[model samples]
Target: MNKQQKIIIISIVALTALLAWVVLKPVQPSDTATTTTPHEAASEHAHDHSYDHSYDHAQAGDTHDDEDVVTLSDAQAASAGIVLDMVKPAHIFTMLTLPGEIRFNQDRTAHIVPRVDGIVEAVTVDLGQQVKKGQVLAVLASTGVSELRSDALAAQKRLSMAKTIYAREKELWEDKISAEQDYLQAQQDLQEAEIAAQNTTQKLHALGAGTSAKGGLNRYELRAPFDGMIVERHLSLGESVQANANVMTLADLSSVWAEIVVSAKDLGTVKVGSSVTVKASAFESQSSGVVSYVGSLLGEQTRTATARVTLPNPDLAWRPGLFVNVEIVAGEANVPMAVTTEALQTVEDREVVFVQTAEGFRAMPVKTGRSDGKMVEIVEGLQAGAAYVTKGSFTLKSELGKSAAEHTH
Candidate 1:
């Protein structure tokens, strides 16, 4: 019994000691915590790297912006036909462009008419036919012409009779073979006949009819007054034309008129003797002329004044009724910086000119002043001697727009 009790007591005390040691021992961290901390740190490093990558990308985008440029190889430029020019001083004219129409020069235009009533026997000219001065346009059978010739012939015969009688009487009186009254009467008759003849000749001259040697007294000829192109024809064969009937219209096409209707505001700008450029709309012909007339009266219906430019159309290119543009140069100004008008482009509501740079051409905005169609005055944002695109600047503008769109994206 003693041995058994001692063994049992020893076992119980050993079990209690094991339990106390187990309860009093300090706690240690788990392997899962170590593994989780490392995973979190790796995630944080990856996030920081991603942020750095985005920052670098933003910096690169800023660099691109600082140099808003376009680069084209020499071959590409040549193929595009890009022309470059340097800024220089030039005279730019301020011009006022107005709509106009080509018209017959009224000063050199004529409406041919038969002075006496007649029947048109033949029409020698047609519409659009060119004729020289004194060229017969048509022939007529005129009764009035016949009467004029008859009167002239009668007067000539009477003058011949009076001359013979006067000669005989003068000879008799000088020889003292005739009375003084008879000689005086003969002299008075001769004077009367001369007066009648002169009156008849003047009347025939006024009628534009000369005594016909061919005995066709009624023959009347309508002739051209000047060298001109026939623009209109009214008389035909066998047509009866009255006195003062306009048979044909002839216009000197060598010179034409550019009739411009100017507004009241622009009346002062367009004055007589001012130089003008006339451009035909139907064709690519331009001529320079002087303003010959500026009407004092404005049209009541149109409320505009008529201005005329006498253009020499030696080639007959400026036909009547053709539309035209009249550019009146008001004045000229000397500018320090100027460029071709083709070089100027409107971008973002600003006038821009592509300037040559080390890398490429950069679109630069500019302020402009006076301008003719050929050249324009660059008031600001451009310096003399700076190279710029002249002929093909529009292509650069399109390129710039594309670049801007890409940037926005």
Candidate 2:
């Protein structure tokens, strides 16, 4: 029984192995059929992916081409009417500008003061009135005037009595009816009387009263010391004024002081005897003067120094305290190259300008010099009257910056 079962199991196992081989074995194609191996198919897929990735990369690069490119042609520039210019020469004046005010010259100003304490009985001159030297400006009344008059009158009476006594004594001595001592005394008395009369007359003169035969009463009169306009008056009619009180302030406006405030750093340029041009707002004309004084002390708040120039004011048009713009011409250049201030451009740390050339507007580097308000002196790399782009310089500068950025890429 065991031999027969073993024979059957061997046959079944053999059949199972044959079937397994047939099911598991790969199928074979005919010679006419084309096919790819696993490795070959994988290689083909990898090649396709590489090609697609390269194509996409190329498309992305082309998409951004319009943004990074610029096409500036000579024809387009010429169509825009860009032109070139030649350099020229001109004079350049260097100036120090300052603000100033008009003031009365101290040398030509006067203060009218009363000589005696009195009530101001009359004020003949008013503010802004023109007066001549020795002109009576006011009349004052005081007890001092009455005392002076009484003393003069008393001296006159005493002199007359002494003269009468002396004449009588001299007549007696001449007739030999009196001693020689008496006649001597009479001569001394007459001399004394004449001396007293002269002393009284001199006192009256000192009090500003005339020594006339009529001998009028003395009255205090305030007079102008010089020929000038009365700019201020402190006394009114019937106002009590003290001795040595200022009654009026007078100013001779033939000349005035132009006081200017200059920065301390510019003190070197502003010196005495320098020429100055003062422009006032009230008048359309400009006044020229010489610098008379430069203050040594600096202002604490403004850090500026005061300078004064004396200018003639014959027309009295320049009033005191009027604001003015002052320009002090420090020096001049005979043939200097300069340009308008608007033509200058700044790029980062570099100061630049557009120069008109054969090609077009080309950016230029320049060194600059002193500048007035309207024009600037060119120290290097620019010529006078060379038509650099003054108005549209910023537009050109922006385009140049864009172009520079493009070249970096």
Candidate 3:
């Protein structure tokens, strides 16, 4: 063959080989395409088969088939872990709570004031000192007593002279040696002197000066008027105190007043003679008493009425000015159907309680009456001897909500 022909034949052979490679060679998958490989697909398929078998085994262990499924629309008719006592005839006490303060009884409180103006000579009672009735709390000096002593001395001198003259005149009259007018005049003078002296003595006694031997009027003695503890002292030794000035405040803590500020709305519910329970944070003590007084007028600022509870303070644990909580028993209903407070729940604005039934717990709309802390009186919608769920009703309620949402969907 010629050289050119041989070259053309070789070129055509090479071109045909290239065309065959382009047509028959495998094309690589694009980056955007699914990356699943044959080996991976096989592995996933095997895993899925094993997972189905394990799920079947788990379902077999449960024993509950699809036929055992039970659905409840109401929470009260659903099964719950907690059970409640059947409502029955019982007494329910209604309580009204109010914030209060510990106070000294007005009748038991005394303000120690000097009857006469004087400098405080000595303070016998300190603040918070227990004192007895007629106890000398403090001593003072006053010019008022000195004037009284001077008046008494003058009266005594006049009385002595009058007595001497009267005795002489009486002896003369008995012997018929004096005129009747002269004897009568002498008797009148002696009577006048005695009256003057008695008046002076009375004045001293009223000034609380009868105890002092020295006619020296030290108006300094300030005594407690009643058996009580000195809650406040406004005077110190050598401090000049004015007449009618408050020296100390005393209170008989054996009995105290629990003063509560009640809202005007609660005024009708609170009345005199209502039972009251008082609690204070100052001491771990609780006291029971009765409402002794209720203010007819409302407070100018708060528009609340004041109610006083008389509580016995034998231990003196309750002090004045201590904040306290007061609970008053407003009323009571006898033989009322009642249930635990926890059994009652609020559904919207209406009150409800869970009533247990064969199906589950069914929410029973109930009318609630007075609540006595632990239990609430059922006014309507529940019968005596009906079992109910007290606790765990919340869980049932949540389940009911889920069911409701599903229905809505």
- Return the top candidate by TM-score: 1
Kindly report which residue pairs in candidate 2 clash with one another: none
lDDT of 2 by residue, 172-259 (tens): 9889999989878877877887788788778767766544434235467778778899999998988998878888899999899999
lDDT ranking from best to worst?
1, 3, 2
Query: What is the clash tally of candidate 3?
Result: 10
Q: Is candidate 1 or candidate 2 better by TM-score?
A: 1
By summed lDDT, the worst window of 10 consecutive residues in model 3 runs over: 63-72
Q: Which one wins by TM-score: 1 or 3?
A: 1
Candidate 2 lDDT trough over 10 residues, lowest sum: 63-72
**Can you write out model 3's per-residue Cα lDDT over 203-247, one digit (the tens) per residue?**
877866663445355454666778888888898878988878987
Checking candidate 3 for backbone clashes, the offending pairs are: 76-361, 76-362, 77-360, 77-361, 77-362, 78-360, 78-361, 139-220, 140-220, 140-221
Predictions: Cα RMSD each? 5.8, 12.9, 12.0
Question: RMSD in angstroms, candidate 3?
Answer: 12.0
Candidate number that wins on lDDT, 2 or 3: 3
The clash numbers for all candidates, in the given order, read 0, 0, 10
